[model samples]
Target: MKPRLPQLDRPVRMPSRSRILAAVIMLAVILGPFVGHLLGAGHGQAATPVEPLPLDSLLRQAEDQSPQVLRQLLLALVMSLCCTAIHLAVTVLVVVSYESHSLMAWASRTPLGRITLIAGTAMVTFLAMFVEILSWAALYLQQGAILPVEEALYFSSVTFASLGYGDITLDLPFRLLASLEALVGILMAGWSTALLVAVIQKCLALRFHRTDHGSDPTTATNP
Candidate 1:
């Protein structure tokens, strides 16, 4: 009788405390504004609902000179920088995961693996943008620009996507934030696209290399 080799089961890796804490902090930043709004309502102090101002009012507010505009611009600058830093950090983490986990090898072995990698990379990018948008929504609420947290977040999402639905409008001071967020969204989308393309290229090259090295049988063999 032939001897059978024993199979070893792969160990599942549990998330470390630091990683779990980081995730919690990310979620808190994303949902804290909404939670606070709910708490305020429960305490018998409901936030004033946001109402769109008339065009004349909006234009007048826009033309009025104030230091609030400067403050808002500075805030926008800081938030943009923070979002950029986070996006870059996420890119670094993705690249690190790919290398550490030998994702290229897995990708080269199967088309499904490559697709999974692409989907995962995209999800990470989406999550990074969500956090940034939520931060801006929280800031808008804090600045009292928008009355309701949900309205602020809705505005943030619309502006981030550059949808410009115009159902809700911000005064000039806070409008600057929306403009900056739209620009950030465009830039981040470009960055993510580049990353996805690079990953695809790497995966394809890995497969080519394996075939050239005679490791993969799909390549044509020289007669």
Candidate 2:
């Protein structure tokens, strides 16, 4: 036989965290103005040009707002990080519980059991998300950014879901915070969807593996 070339078996490496963050920031900077223009266009309003401020006035305004801007950024970061941690903790607990019990493992083999598992997981995740939304609403209420408890919760729910009904709007000070909430919501929603897909995929894989070997699913170790 002729000499055979060796196959490359190396796994692909993922981008580093710093690179990913840089890319995101770069994309946002490039796209931000275009998105703002589109949003303004949707409002059917004409842009009005104002006289430019002097350098000293601009610097003074920036200095005055910097503290508030930093505070809002910190708040957004903390809230998003907390929500991420909560989601991860819940996911780990669920996977551990499913793997630890033989009954759960065996049940995952059947259609009905798998349906139940998915539904339970959905409900638990929903509750977690609801709590997160409530926390944000409480913040808005405490800040008096939105009046009436009901309205605050409504705005929080809509923003967190990225629905953006636009019927209700936060005051100028909190508008940036709301935008941050929308971003966090999008990320959390994607993460939850991924978790559901992973659970379904794992269940299907386990079912097929057990069916092929004709072995007890309970005795099969989890990946």
- Backbone clashes under 3 angstroms, per model: 0, 0
- Between which residue pairs do clashes occur in model 1? none
Candidate 2, 1-223: lDDT as tens digits: 9999887799779899999999999999999999999998966654655678999999999999999999899989988988898888879977886766665665656777777777888887888788889988988888889979999999999999999899999788898999999999998898888888887786786677777986766676655
Best by lDDT: 2
lDDT of 2 at 14: 89
Residue pairs with colliding backbones in model 2 are: none
TM-score of each: 0.63, 0.73
Off by over 4 Å in 2: 1-49
